[model samples]
Target: MTLFTVDPATVTPAPFTDDDWAFTLLRCLASPSTEEYPPARLCGFLFLAPDRLRLYFGTEPDLPGTTAADVRPGGALTALLAALPSLLDEQRLTKTDTDDPHCSRVVDLTGW
Candidate 1:
C-alpha cells in the first residue's frame, strides 16, 4: 500500500489502498462541498486516467448504496472496491501529490 501525506501535521495520511481511495471517493461524493473540487456531480461518471481520477454526475448514473435496489450489474464500482483491497503491487499505490491546478493529488494505480 502507498502512504498519503497531509499538509498539516495534525492530519493523518491515508494508507495507499484501493479501499482507501474508494472510501475517499465515497465521502467526497456524499458531501456538498464543491469549492475544493471542480465542476462535477456524484452520479455523472468517473474519469480514471493515468494521471487523475475525478467523479462527475450530470445526467450520469448515480451510484446506489450496496443495499440499494438499483445497484449496477456486477456491482460495478462496488465490485471494484472489493477487488481493490487485495491489490498486491504495494509500490503502485503511491500517491503523487502536486501543486498543479488541474489535479492536486493523483494516485496512479494504472498497471495494477
Candidate 2:
C-alpha cells in the first residue's frame, strides 16, 4: 500500500478543527449512493495526528484474488471524495458489505 500525508487544512472547510475535519471526511466517505455514483466501501480510517488521516479501501468484492488499488493522487480532499464513488462503481474498490457479520463486523459510526 502507498502511504501519503495530507494537511487537514487542505481537505476541510472553515473552522478547521480536528474533530470537525474528521467528521467531515467520515461523512464524505460514507455518503449515500446515487444512480450515477455508488457508495464508497470504506475499509477503515485512522487519525495519525490532528493534521493527518489514513484511509483504507477494501478489495474489489468480485475479484478477491487481486490486491486492492491505492487511492490515486487527487491533490485535494474534494477531489479524493469525488473519485471514490466512481472507483467503487467501476469495480476498482469493493462494495459495502451489509450482510454476514460472521465474516466481518461493520462499525456503525452514526450514533457517535
Candidate 3:
C-alpha cells in the first residue's frame, strides 16, 4: 500500500476557543446512512463569521431542501461545534456559486 501525508499549511487551523470546526465538518460529511437522512456524500464549503455560520450544499447531495418553516436539520458538525444552534441551523442549498453572497469585507486575524 502507498502512504500519503497532508501538508500542514494547506489545512485551516482550528481556533483556540473550540475543539476543531474542520474536524467536525469532516465528520458530518462522513455520516452513516439512517432512516431519515442518507449518508452524506459531499460536504459543501463552510462560511464562518462571529455572528453567523452557514453551510452550502448542492442538490446533488441527496439531502432534502429547506422546509416550509425555513429551518432544517443542519449537518451535525454545526450543531455540535458551533454552539449557536438556532443561528447555525439555516443552510443555503444552492447549485451555483453566483447566488452565494460575496464577501465584501474580510478581516485578517492571522497576525493576531
Candidate 4:
C-alpha cells in the first residue's frame, strides 16, 4: 500500500493559451499480457513566450527542427495539455513516468 506523491505544483496543469508550447514526458511501457491498450501516462509542463521546453529521460530529448509541422505536437505544456486528447488520438497511447522506478525524468521550462 504505497501512495505516490509529486509536488502538487509540479503536477499542476497550465492554462490553455495560444503561444504555449507543450513539453510532454512520456514513459513507454511494455505490455506483459499483450493488452491492447498497454500501460501509459502523460506527465509534462507548458511554456509561454520567453519560456521553452526541455526534457531529459536519462538521455536528451529531441528538440524541434526548423519545420513547425513536426514541432506542433511537441509544443509547450499549455498547448500540449489543451491538445492532449488530440495527441493521444493521433498516437493512440499515453505513458507515465511511474512505469519505471529508477527512471528520472526532468522537463525544463526554458525558452519558447
Best by lDDT: 2
The candidate that achieves the highest TM-score relative to the unseen native structure: 2
Q: Note the Cα lDDT for every prediction shown.
A: 0.38, 0.48, 0.35, 0.31
After aligning candidate 4 to the native by TM-score, how far in Å is the CA of 64 from where it should be?
A: 28
Q: List the residue pairs that clash in candidate 2.
A: none
Stretches of candidate 3 exceeding 4 Å from the true structure: 1-16, 31-41, 60-112
Off by over 4 Å in 4: 1-40, 43-75, 91-112
Work out the TM-score per prediction.
0.25, 0.43, 0.29, 0.18
lDDT of 3 by residue, 1-112 (tens): 9999999999999644332544454465456434554322333434354323333332233334421111123334444433322222234422222333532112221111
Question: 1-112 in candidate 4: lDDT tens per residue?
Answer: 9998889877878775434323122222111234554222323222323333322212223322110111232344345444433333232232233333333322222222
lDDT of 2 by residue, 30-105 (tens): 6744554433466666564565554555545633322222332223657656654444335323334535332232
Better of 2 and 3 by TM-score: 2
Tell me the spans in candidate 2 whose CA falls farther than 4 Å from its real position.
1-14, 33-40, 62-75, 85-112
